[model samples]
Target chain A: MSDQTYVTSDPRGSITQLATPSRLEYFFTAGTSLSKNLRGYQRGQFIGQRCPVCSKVYVPSRGSCPVDGVALTEEVELKNTGTVTTFCVVNVPFAGQSIKIPYIAGQILLDGANLSFMGLIQECELEEVRMGMRVEAVWVDKEDLVPSLASVKYFRPTGEPDAAYETYQEYL
Target chain B: MSESPEIFTSPHVLEFPYSRSTGPVIGSFLTALRDGVLIGIKGTGGKVIFPPTEYDPDTAEETSGIVNVGPGAVVTSWGWVNQPLKQHPLQHPFAWALIQPDGADTAMLHVVDAGSESAMATGMRVTAIFRPADERIGAMADLIAFVPEEAK
Candidate 1:
């Protein structure tokens, strides 16, 4: 890359800054869609869609089915509980991370859902948590409620036996 | 007027659309914030964090617990932006700080009211300057910006 630089604020200053686009916008005129029918899970409800061709279930549904590549319809609710497939410890800090260092971010497969989602693990020591561990959802206070994914706070172990690897192998 | 020699250069442009999927859980939290509320997700350990996160950054499990964090926050770490960039919130010199509101375990990045580097400190206090109700948008800017608390 060329390292050409230009002055940002001061016209007479010798320091030069990189020239780049200041703003950007997108227009999806070609018709975009969601993979599954989304629902407000914090309100104690489940949501997803079923593909007409393969009859597969998808939560937070997409616009089209990955199997047959056809539009999916028929919304369905899923259970909030699920299993942890894999995870990582965020020991290193980065920009925009609000929480303290040495936190854990993991992927969870909600009950009755085919896909896994990422979330935080809390309420127990990092060492106490394990793979294939059973966890449950914790909702935010009602006063601070929103329609986004931050609704569920973090997952805590239920002290139940780790799920059998065969049960969630496909999720991995 | 006499013609001047012109410099020729290729204008390189970079752009990308971030398709953020606000899953059902976080989607509701953002929706609530848009309606004028500060929310946090309660981790299984009972610690609360602002800017409600989808999963516990520590365990990688799904989070369903929620909590109301604050109408105010504390300055945790800070830096002076004497030289402003185009994307920065303010065109004038300002301080960028991490504010941890009461009851929340994490800190949020924001601008502070210290006019000069000397006025701002790591432990100083500040509060949210909510945007006018009519101008509210579903983003951090919706909080407008944070300013230093007036000397009592």
Candidate 2:
């Protein structure tokens, strides 16, 4: 066993704590539009952007279309039920986390949306959460409504038929 | 084998805030510390915590008490920093340690005057070194650094 310890003394009879200034950051302006679309998801609605050139749809659209690098237009509504593409178990606890440890965080692709979004999976055991498992969005109380991601609580299994690996393989 | 890649870069700007919401108990303790008084929060476990915290570590309950901790403390753990960072208290090499002040159950962090690692050791007794009265601020820098007590 190690017997070593560490210590320091305040020059004054007692120490006075210091406060440092906070830092600021700025990202691309496209983030603003993306944020608005995310807010719509909180209202139990699905939305995405349609690429003008290739017609490929982008959920949580970006300023520049990925394939053609062109700006996307025409907002579209998507189905709520989707297939789980990939997932991981959050076994470790963090400082401000509300949910207990050993919860699952997963990525899901809605039925009509071209892209997938990440969310938590609950109402099932850690071992039971699998790829291609059907899941649906769970919402928070109406009083807790906010223009934030936490609006939809988590996705629970819908007990729909499991999707084949080849069906949604490209989304993986 | 393929040629090894080489990369070059200058110092990058990095920034973030250490956002902390001090609970009522800690806020009061900081208020007291700013007034130049050492105060400790007595915990349910009978341990008196200096630089008092809002929640008791053992019981996780709000703690209370305004016990004066020290005019001095002993160095418990220490490290010599020869190359100081931009935000460090001192630009020169100094010792950083967890100090257990007189009448305090928990230790507080601060710097010391020990010039080198060879000169600092666990259990080495030290005393608070205060700044000039006019320069005193409500921060740990008010105590410039802990100095070794003179040998009797």
Report the C-alpha lDDT of model 2 over B63-142, residue by residue, as the tens digit: 65557777678899988898997778988898889988899988888898876677788998888766665665545566
lDDT of 1 by residue, B1-152 (tens): 11113211223444643346555445545444455566677655766756667667887655556666666778999989989987778889888888887788988887775778887877777777776755654456666566777732
In angstroms, how far off is B18's CA in candidate 1? 17
Tell me the chain A TM-score of model 1.
Answer: 0.76
Model 1 chain B lDDT-worst window of ten: B1-10
Give a tens-digit lDDT track for model 2, residues A1-172: 2111111233443323335646544332325446546656557666678888988777777656888988776777777788899999998887567888888989988887778889889998899999999998887887775445577788999988898887678898
Tell me what fraction of the real C-alpha contacts between chains A and B each candidate also makes.
Answer: 0.02, 0.09
Q: Which numbered prediction scores highest in lDDT against the true structure? A: 2
Residues A33-116, candidate 1, lDDT per residue (tens digit)? Answer: 231122254354556777888787776565678879998766767776788899888898765579887888888877777778
Q: Least lDDT summed over 10 consecutive residues: which range in candidate 2 chain B?
A: B1-10
Worst 10 residues of 1 chain A by lDDT: A1-10
